[model samples]
Structures are given as C-alpha cells and as structure tokens.
Target: MKLISWNVNGLRACVNKGFNEYFAEEDADIFCLQETKLQEGQISLDHGEKYRQYWNYAVKKGYSGTAVFTKKEPLSVSIGIEGVEETEGRVITLEYEGFYLVNAYSPNARRDLSRLAYRLEWEDRFRAHLKRLDKQKPVVICGDLNVAHQEIDLKNPKSNNGNSGFTLEERGKMTELLASGFIDSFRHLHPDTKDVYSWWSYMPKVRERNVGWRIDYFLVSERLAPAIADARIECAVMGSDHCPVVLELNGF
Candidate 1:
C-alpha cells in the first residue's frame, strides 16, 4: 500500500496550484493533508467516487485543520485526542482492519517561544494517544509534526539551534516519541541522507536554495518497520512551502 502526506499550508490556495492534478496522478491508497487553513464549506475537492473524504475543521475560520482521502473505508474514524479539547482541528484517526492511521497537524511553537510550553504539553498528550492506539494495533502516524527532529533534519542547524522548531526541548520530545516504539520511516530508510526536506521557508530564495526542514513525517509502530518498502520526499513537487512525503508498505 502507498500513502502520501503533505502539509498544504492552505488547501484552497494549493488547489489553485494544481493539487487536484497531482492527487489524481499519485493515486495513492491513502492521501493525508495538514494545515488546510479553511472552515467547512470553504472549498470542495473532487477526488472521484473511489475515495472517501474525511475532514476535521477548526472552529476558527481560515486556520489549522486536517483531512484524509482514502480509497478504502476505515472501520472507524476519530477526531482529536481523547480528553483533549482541541479547537484547532489538529488530528484525525482512521481505524482500518490492519492498522490505525493517524493524521496530525502538531501545534507550532511560535517564533517568540510564547507557545512553546503549550506545544510541549500537546506533544505529551499526542504521544500518549499514539501509545494507546499502538496497544490496540500498529499505528501509521503522519503530518507536519512541526519540529525538525534532529540536526540532520533542517538546514543550518547550528544557527537555528534555539529556534522554535529546532529547539532542544522540541527535539527531545521527538526523541522520546520515537523511543516509545515508533520509527521515523524516512530517516529509518535513509539514515544518512541529507539536504532533502519537506518544508521550506517562504522567504525569498529559501526554497530556491533548498534551505528547508523535514518537519513532515510518516511514523509507524516499531513492529511495522519490516513492512516499510520505501520512504521518500517528493522535493520536486511545488504548490505549498512544503512538499509531499511518500511511504510504501508491503503486506499491508
């Protein structure tokens, strides 16, 4: 099975940039999106009748949100983490016969670090949620995690060491998550690959120069690691500041 995850930055704006065309071409078993930045009834996507659409929209208009398009219907679908009052529509989960697929748009710690504490708290809750799912079945977690996990994940790590996404605290939280029985699919596949990234700054020349961060990911339960056929970044595709990350799994 093939799955693709991308943080479109804004789904409406991305659609104008050929999202539909790309979506049709990929024809993945499941396609997930983050940071949709739209409320209900803002836009419509025609993915053909083969796909089932599931959306979790934020209460605030034109803000954070997520969606999933899958060829196969799941056994059950869930919105947000249990016990958490998530108003930003940051997460959605689909329970298939074989696994639990989680689509998450993690909260970004603002540049000033004012939201860092809240972001950390959210991470803890998110990790706990994943752990609970893992106990039931293997989990496929994907989206813009909003952190560049390690020094190898972003360009100029030295200069951006203390920045919001690259900070020690954020990186540590990612480490803790991975240690809790999850594998970062791309990094697990290409251990030493560098300069490849999923997200780039919109500043002038940033994307052109390939100065970016691999904040988006597809993480699976440790036991599913053997089924990982391929994990890659589609850096050449363009529409949003972020590109798509693809994962191929064998034996379902």
Candidate 2:
C-alpha cells in the first residue's frame, strides 16, 4: 500500500496551486493531510471520487487541522489523543483491519518558545496514544511532527541549533517516541542520506538553496518495519512550504 502525508498549509490556497492535479498524479491509496487551516464547509476535493474523506477541523477558522483520504474504509476513526484537548485539530486516526493510521500536526513551539511547555505536554500524551494503538495493532503515523530530529534531518544543524524545531527538548521527545517501539521510515531506508528535506522556509532563497528541515514523516510501529518497502520525500513537488512524504508498504 502507498501512504502519503503533506502539510498543505492551507487546503483552500493549495487548491489554487494545482493541488488537485498533484493529488491525482500521486495516486496514493491513503493521503493524510496536516495543517489544513480550514473549518467545516470551507473546502471540498474531487480528485478521487472513490476515496473516502475524513476531516477534523478546529473550532478556530483558518488554523490548525487535519484530514484523511483513503481508498479503504477504516473499521473506526478518532480525533485526538486522550487528555490533550486539541482545539486546534492536530490529529486524526483511522483503524483498519491490521493497522491504525494516524495523521498529526505537532504544534510549533513558536519563535520565542512560548508554546514549548504545551508542546512538551503534547509529546507525552501523543506518545502514550500511539503506544496504546500499537498494542492493538501495527500503526502507521504520518504528517508534520514539527521537529528536525538530528543533524542529518536539516541542512545546517550547527547554525540552526536551538531553533524551535531543533531545540534539545523537542529532539528528545522524538527520541522518546522512536525508543517506544516506533520507527522513522525514511531514516531507516537512508540513514546517511543528506540534503533531503520536506519543509522549507518561505524566504525566497531558502527553498532554492534546499535549506530545509525534515519535520514531516511517515513513522510506523517497529513490528511493521519489514513491510516498509520504501520512503521518499517529494522535494520537487511544491505548493506549500512543505512537500509530501511517501511510504510504500509491501502489502495493502
């Protein structure tokens, strides 16, 4: 099966940038979207009419949100991790026969780190949630995790040290997650791969220089690692500041 995740930034705006065409071209069996930045009744997609669409919109307009488009129907679905109280609409989970697919958009710590406390709290709850799901079945977690895990994940680790996504605290949370029986699919495939990134700044020269971060991911439960045939970053595809991350599994 093929699963793809992307932080569209804003579904409405991306649609104008040929998002529909891009969506169809990828032809993912399941497409998970983060940072939708829209509420109910705001956007609709018809790229694949056979796919079932599920959305979790925040109470606030034009803000954080997530959605999932899947070719297979899930046994059940959920909104967010328990006790997190995510009014920003940060997560969505679909329970299939053999696995749970979670789409998430981890909160940014802000340039000043004002939201760091909340982000930490989120990490704990989020990890717990995934662990619980993993106990039931293998899990496929995807979307923008909002952190550049290691030096290889971004272009300039030395210069970007202590930045919101690269801060020690944030990187530690990621380590905690992977230690808790999850695997970072892309890193597993290309451990020494460099310069491959999923998110870039809006600055004119940043994207061109390929100065970006690998904040987005397609992480799966450790037990399912053998099924991960390939993982890729679609750096050439562009609409938002972020690009889509793809994971191909051995069996759908």
Candidate 3:
C-alpha cells in the first residue's frame, strides 16, 4: 500500500498553487493532509469519485484542521483523540481491516514558546492515544508532527537548538514515542541521509538553500517495519511551506 502525508498549510491557497495537479499525479492509495485551515462548505475538492474524503474541522473557523482522502474506504472513521475534548480538530483515525491509520497535526509551541506547556501536555495525551490503538492493531500514524526530533532532522541544529520545534522537550517526546513501539519510517530507511527536509521557513533563501526541518513523518508500529518498502521526503513539491512525505508498504 502507498500512502502520502502533507501539511498543506492552507488547503484553499494550496489548490490555487496546483495542489490538484500534484494530487492526481501522485495517485496515492491514501493521501493525508494537515493544517487544512478551513471549515465545512468552505471549499470543495474534485479529487475524482474514486477517493473517499474525511475531514475534521476545528471549532474555530479557518484555523487548524486535518483531512484524509483515500482510495479505499475504511471500516470505521473517528475524530479526535480518546479522553480528550478536541476543539482544534487535529486528529482523525480511520480503522481499516488490517491496521489503524491516524492523521494528526500536532500543536506548535509558537515562536515565543508560549504554548510549550500545553504542547507538552498534548504530547502525553497523544502518545497515550496511539498506544491504545496499537493494542488493538498495528498503527500507521502520519502528518506534520511539528517537531524536528533530532540534530539530523533539521539543518543547522546548533542554531535551531531550543527553538519551538527542536527543543529538548519536544524531541524527547518523539524519542519516547519511538521507544514505546513505533518507528520513524524515513529515518529508519535512510538513517544517514542528510540535507533532506519536509518543512521550510518562509524566509528568503530558506527553501532554496534547503534550510528546513523534517517535521512531517509517517511512523508505523515497530512490527510493521518489515513491511516498509519506501519512505521519502518529497521536497520538490510546492504549494505550501511544507512538502509531502511518502511511505510505501508491502503485504499490508
């Protein structure tokens, strides 16, 4: 099975920048999106009739949101994380016959780190939520997780250290998640690959120079590692500050 995850930044704006063309060209089995930044009835997407769409819109209009478009219909679909009142519409879980697919847009700590405390708390709950799903079946979690994870994950880590996404707290949570039973698919497959990134700053020459972070990911249960056929960063694709990440699995 092939899956793609991208942080569109804003779906409407991205569409104008040729999102549809890229979507059709990739033709992934499942395409997950983050930071949709729209509510219902805001915009309609013509992705053909073959794909089924699922959206989670935030209570706040034009804010944080997520969506999934899949060629295969899931057995069940759910919104939000367990035991949490999710007002931001950051998570969507689709239950398939073989595994659970979770699309999440994790909260950013903000430029001033004002939301760091809340972000940390959210990480704890999110981890718990994933663990619960893993107990039932292997899980495929993907999206813009909003963390750089390690030094190799971002360009100029020394300069970015303690920044919102690269802080020790944020990276530690990611480490904890992987330790619990998940595998970061891209890093697992290309452990030494450098100068590859998914999200970039809008600053002049940032993206051009490849000064960015691998904040987006496709993490699978450790047992599913053997099924991983490919995991890649689609850095060339454009529409938003972030590009798409692709994952391919075999015998799913």
Candidate 4:
C-alpha cells in the first residue's frame, strides 16, 4: 500500500497550483493533508470520485485543519484524541482492518515561542494517544509534525538551533516519541540522507536553494518497520511551501 502525507499550507491555495494534477500523478492509496486552513463547505475537492474523503474542520474559519482521501474506505473514522478537548481540527484517525492511520497536524510553536508550552503539552497527549492506539493495532502516523527532530533535518542546524521547530525541547519530545515504539520511516530507509527536506521557507530563492526542513513525516509502529518498502520526499513537486512525503508498505 502507498501512502502520501503533505502539509498543503492551505488546501484552497494549493488546489489553484495544480494540487489535483500532482495528486493524480502520485496515485496514492491513501493521501493525507495537513494545514488545510479551511472549514467545511468552503471548498470542494474532487479526487476522481473514487476516494472516500474525510475532513476535520476547526471552529475558527480558515485555520488549522486536516483531511484524508483514501481509495479504500476506512472501517471507522475518529475526529480527534478521544479524551482531549481539542477544537483546532488537528487530527483525523482512520481505522482499517490492518492498521490505524493517524493523520495529524501538530501545533506549531510560534516564531516567538509563545505557543511552545502548549505545543509541548500537546505532544505528550498526542504520543499517549498513539500508544493507546498501538495497543490495538499498528499505527501509521503521518503529517507535518512541526518539529525538525535532528540537526541533519534542517539546512543550517547551527543557525536554526534555537528556533521554534528546531528547539532542544521540541527535538527531545520527538526523541521520546520515537523511543516509545514508533519509527521514523524516512530516516529508517535512508539513515544518512541529508539536505533532503519536506518544508521550505517561502522567501525568494529559498526553495531553489533547497534550504528547507524535514518537518513532515510518515511514521509507523516499530513492528511495522519491516513492511516499509519505500520512504521518500517528493522535493520536485511544488504547490505549497511543503512537499509530499511518501511511504510504501509491502503486503498491506
């Protein structure tokens, strides 16, 4: 099975930039999106009429949200963490016979770090949620995690060290999550891969220079690692500041 995750930045804006064209070309069995930035009824997406589309929209209009488009219908769908009081529409859980797919748009620690505390708190809750799901079945977690977990994940680690996405605290939280039994599929496939990133700054020539951060990911439970046939970043595709990250699993 092939799955693709992308932080479209804004789904409506991305659609105008040929989102459907690229989506068709990829032909993912399950396609997930983050940062959709729109509420229900604002935009209609026609993914060839074959996909079973599921969306989670925030109460606030034109803000954080997520969506999933899968060719195979899920056995069940969940909006957010079961016990957590959330309203940003940051997550969608789709349960299949084989695994649970958790599509998440992690809260971004703002540029000023004002949201850092909330971001960290959310991380703990999110990790706990995944662990609970893993107890039932393997979980495929994908989206813009909003943090660059390692020094090699960004263009200039030295200069970006203390930034919101590259902060020590944020990185540590990612480490904790991985240690808790999830594997970062991309890194597992390409251990030493460097300079390849999923997200780029919108500044002039930044994308051309490939100055970017690997914030988006396709992570699976540790036991599912052997099934990861391919994990890659589609850097050449362009629509949003972020590109698509893909994971192909065998015999799933």
Q: Candidate 4 lDDT, tens digit per residue, 1-252?
A: 999999998999999998999999889999999999998888988767789999998888889899999999899999998666769999999999999999999998999999999999999999999999999999999999999999889999999988999999999999999999999999998999999999999899999999999999999999999999999999999999999999999978
Q: Assess candidate 4 and give its lDDT.
A: 0.94
lDDT tens digits by residue: candidate 2, 44-160: 777556799999998898998999999988999999889988698999999999899999999999999999999999999999999999999999999999999999999999998
lDDT of 1 by residue, 98-163 (tens): 999999999989999999999999999999999999999999999999999988999899999999
Q: After TM-score superposition, what is the CA distance of residue 195 in candidate 2 from its true location, in Å?
A: 0.2
Question: Which of the two candidates, 3 or 4, achieves a greater lDDT against the reference?
Answer: 3
List the global CA lDDT of all models. Answer: 0.95, 0.94, 0.95, 0.94
Superposed by TM-score, candidate 2 places the C-alpha of residue 194 at a distance from the truth, in angstroms, of 0.2
Every model's TM-score: 0.99, 0.98, 0.98, 0.98
Cα lDDT of model 3 by residue, 167-187, tens digit: 999999999999999999999
Q: In model 2, what are the clashing residue pairs, if there are any?
A: none
User: Candidate 3 at residue 7, lDDT?
Assistant: 94
